[model samples]
Target: MLAQLTNVSLSFPDKKVLQDVSFTVYPGDRISLVGPNGAGKTSLFKILTGRLNPDAGAVSRAGGVRIGHLEQDLSDSASGHELTCMEAALEPFAGLIRLEKRLEEIAVKLGREGHASVLMEELGEAQRRFEDSGGYSFRARTEATLTGLGLPESLWDREVSGLSAGQRMRLALARILLEEHDLVLFDEPTNHLDVPAREWLEGHLKNSKVAYMVASHDRRFLDAVSEKVAHLDRANLSLYTGDYTAFRGQVERAEEEGWRRYEKSRKQERKLRRQAQDYRAWSEAGERAKRGAADKGFVSHRAAKVMKRSLVARRRMEEAAENARAEKPFEGDEIKIGFGPSRGRGLIRAEDLTIGYSPERPLAAGISFDLSAGERLAVTGPNGSGKTALLRTVLGEVQPLSGGAGVSPTARVGYFDQDHRLPARDVTALEILRGTGDETLARTVLGRMGVRRETVSKPASRLSSGERAKVLLTRLVLGDNDLLVLDEPTNHLDIETQDVLLGALEGFPGGVLFVSHDRHFVDALATKTLRLGIT
Candidate 1:
């Protein structure tokens, strides 16, 4: 095993993140660690990476093991160290640098007059060592990793600090993959990657020799790369052998079996209790007989014995029922998201729309579509393909550089930005929900979304991403908007919550337009698709 966690537990002031979690990662093991938004997958990752010591139990690593963690914080990467992109990526192979220096030294020595033979021998030996140590291939490997991760060769010599946040994260991922680590921990590694980049990464990870554990909400990616799944739910880790789909099947079967056993035990207990009552009645009848018979002592003894046996049988049945009770299946919170009825037939229309900062360099052009009431339209394209720009154009958040876009005068458009940008004002969940002017309805919606009563009073800034998402959706749903425009709505939601949102979208009565990379989600809810930048 490369790393093993035994009975690991962690807790904070307010919540118990993990309890008695244990798992082992072997060489080349592909593990997908999954759970709800607050289910402690991140905490477990911290424990595995030694960033935080577990409150209880042990974490062991093989001797000389090297671990790489793709953390969310890109500020601490090579950019922070003031290194160029190429330099940072190739930094892992210091031996290659040393080998090159030695080769140069030998060349300088060979230039001298008398010691040609000796220098030649030394040069051959160094070259052999370099080749054996992968010195010759390191540069190619680094370049390939950078390119595969969507960082072009043009950016290789550029300063890392000049890159955007997403670019910096991609650079970090490239550098980590270039290094030879025994194991890697990836937390939401696909967050900034486009579809093509994500596909490239999936292929790269599948063929790599290093063990890895990824915590991602992308089910397709999980299904693609994971050989084993480690599900962290209710403070416990359940390891399953197989891909995500198989694990889901296993869980469903297990839940069904548990329910079946529980119901059977309940029925058996009920039958036994009824029989015990009948025995009690019979014993009472015997007591009555004893009161009327001449042999009162014998009759009383029989009645007492019968009563004791009946009580004992009932206790045994109750004990059996208690022992047979199964643990409640984990049914995560549901987020019912939908829109109010649209006012007009043509909710949105874009005619020859060109969206970009300038007309000279448009991200996408000639985009024309119309969304009618009760229709669902999906916008899809690669990164930088103007998907978001197009959506912004339709919503009037951004002016189209060419052509035109329009919404009906009577239609109320609800927009959800990809970055989760809510109102600038600091407010609690309750305050945001109160925008509907119905406190009871707001509370009911929040409760249905699984926002705790106590948490409703807390500031939105204090809530987790999932909680904030719920609050935002509640606001949108309660706003009674006729048309809903969502961008990557299921990005941070747990699987259960995603399902809930999907069901709601599938049944929504109004027009819907959304941008999402989740293929399954798109397939489930999209009635029409607009493919951008795919000519």
Candidate 2:
């Protein structure tokens, strides 16, 4: 075992976040930590890294283990554009390079067979070391990782500072893989990644020999990369052997089996209780018939003891039945979402659109596509395929360049960006509704989405990100535009929430366009996927 967490518990005052979380990280273990949002997954990682102390319990490291963490947003960590991904990866090889150069210089001036042999040996060792550091093959590996992460080759030369938050995160993930470490932890590793990037990461993780723990909301990614899953719930950690898919199956089966076991044991206990009840009733009748005043108290007391012992046994049996029962997650029966037919008539058109950051060198050009009403189009490609940009243009967030345009008016479009608009901001949720004249109806809508009445009246701005997203989604429905465009809508939502959103989209009759890394959501909701690739 590389690391073992024994009776690890954490709490903040009255709220116990984690309770007795015990697990082992072995040499080849790839574990995924999962739970409802705010279940203290991040807290656990902090505890592991010594950033946070557990309220109780202890985490012990076995041997001298090298632990590496891929920190959030690493673009600036590299600090310069002079170093490419390959160069950044090979920083360790700089020392080896210097040693080899000195040895070669000394060997050139001395001409002895022994010295030459020694030189050759050292040179060979250095070369091997460099190769192992991924020096000669570093370019290919870096390029593959970068490309796999949906970054354009052109980005290889771009300043790390120029990258967006998501881009920086991808670069960080790539670099983490480049390093050799005994154990690695990834927190929300797939947050800004695309489908292809996610798949590539999954493949790398599957073939990896190192121990890793990933905190992620992407079920497909978890299913692909993890060999074991850890669920944090009710202040307890439960480990399930196998990937997410296997875990889900196992859990479902366990619940079914639990119900059976509970029923079986419960029935047996009931039978015993009935028999005991009958015996007591007969004993009482005998006492009444024999009513010698002297026998009354003694007989009554003996029979009462018998009844008490039987009841105790019955109580213990019921407790055992309860212990045997399984509590499984309850996926909602359905989430109602309605979208009207898009006002976009026969055609949705982009004419000769040249899109990008600057007018001097636009990202993509001559982009034109028509998505008509009733067409569920999916924009897809590598990470930098300008998918989000295209959606924005469709929504008129970005104006078309010279000689380019989206013919449809902005009013006809509704967009849900990759960064979901709904973040619990400080504004009272009531204000959020009142601002849009949706106050009177807010409670009903929120209740439908699983928000309680008490929760609805509070400020949405004070809510968690997921809660805010829920509120914004309600607004999107209120917007009631014809065309629906979404960007990475599934980013932070858990498996169950993702399912609810999927059900909503699948039933939506309006023209829909959304970009997501989730293959399951894509397959279920998309009518036709548009291949958006950057040159």
Candidate 3:
């Protein structure tokens, strides 16, 4: 086993994040960690890495095991890097490189000193150690990793400090893959990757020998790379065999069974209640007979005996009813999203549109499309292909480099930015929505989205990424928009919430123009597609 966590429990001041969670990581294990946002996935990673201690549990790992962790942010890896890309990629083999240099020195010494026996022995030992450490093929592996992650050969000698944000993220990933660890933990490693890069990563992970645990919201990616799924929900962890699709199927079956059991319990409770009522009526009749008896002793004794039996039967029935009652199964909060009535038929039109910040070097050009009421258009391409730029041009936030793009004047457009930034950092979600003049409605919407009452009062700056996304989505739902333009709308959403959003968009009557990296979502929602960056 690579590592094992037994009976772990963790909690914070306000909530219990994990309870009696236990799992083990074996060699060559490909596990996908899945859960809703704020479900303590990261905290579990921390505990495994020994960066955080569990409130209660025992954690064990094999001796001398090397573990590599790729966090979501690559800022630290990208900073203070003056080395070339190749050099940075090779940083993990510094010890091997030093041993290789010493072998060269030994050769030189042997040549100058007439091949001494001691020098020959030293050279042989160094050579064996270097070979054992994979020093001979580290460079080749590094180059292959860099290229597979979308970095070109031309950028291999370029300074790492000058790489773009996306390139830097790829570089960070390449470094981790080249580290040659026994196991690796990746947290949303595909966040900055385009579709092709994501596919490459999936293929690489599938063929790799190293064990890995990844936490990602990409359903396709999860289905591709995961061999076993570890699901964290409601402060408990459940392990499932097979890929994400199989895990989901198992979960659905379990939920259906739970509902069936609950319904059966309800039926039994109802029957018991009816029997109790009948017995109560019998007891009441016996009491009335005793009260009206004129023969005194004999009639009263018989009536009293009847009343006693009926009362005993009634009490037993009530006890049975109480035992049969079952609490309702938990069906998580529901999100209700609807678009208001549109005033025009045409929502957006773009003719031979060229979008980019620079006129001399356009990112994409010659794009033409028309969206009318109740139609959905998806914009798709690789990274740096100006998908966002096209959305901004349509929304009038950016000036088109050439051609024309316009939205119907009567249409009310609601925009969801990929970055999920709030209008004001200090304003609370409640305050932001209450500004729409219906505090009651705002509270209700927030509650339905599973935002805690305490969370609604907190400033937007303090909210988690998923919470911020929820708040932004709430604003769009309440905006009464006739035309919706969304960029990476499913970035931080869990699978369940993603389904909800997909259903809402499908049922919406207004026009939708969205750019997303999620292939499944795009396939299910788009009526037409616009492909950009085609050479």
Name the 10 consecutive residues with the lowest summed lDDT in model 2: 328-337
Rate residue 234 of model 1 by lDDT: 72
Clashing pairs in 1: none
Q: What is the lDDT of every predicted structure here?
A: 0.82, 0.71, 0.87
Model 3 gets an lDDT of 0.87
Clashes of 3: 0
Instruction: Choose 1 or 2, whichever is better by TM-score.
Output: 1
Tens digits of per-residue lDDT for model 1, 367-447: 889998889999987777888888888888889998999888888878888667667447988988787767877786676
Steric clash pairs (candidate 2): 150-383, 418-487, 424-461, 425-461, 426-461, 428-459, 429-459, 429-460
What is the C-alpha lDDT profile of model 2 across 1-535, one tens digit per residue?
Answer: 8888899888886568988788888888999998766678888887877778888888888777878776543633553556664455445346655655665665664555555666677767766776675556755766787788766677776766667778777777787786778999998888788777788889988888999999888888888888899988768899999999998898889777877766776676666566656655665555554454455777666656665665566566556545544444344344344455565464467777777766875667777677766777877877666887777776667876644556356435566665556544566665666554545565555555545466666775567666666666666655566677777777657676676667666665567778877787788778888777666
Of 2 and 3, the candidate ranking higher by lDDT: 3
Per-prediction TM-score: 0.91, 0.76, 0.90
Superposition error at 298 for model 3 (Å) = 4.4
What C-alpha lDDT, on a 0 to 100 scale, does residue 285 get in candidate 3?
95
Poorly placed runs, candidate 1 (over 4 Å): 78-81, 108-115, 286-302, 324-327, 332-340, 436-453, 464-466
Question: lDDT for model 1, on a 0 to 1 scale?
Answer: 0.82
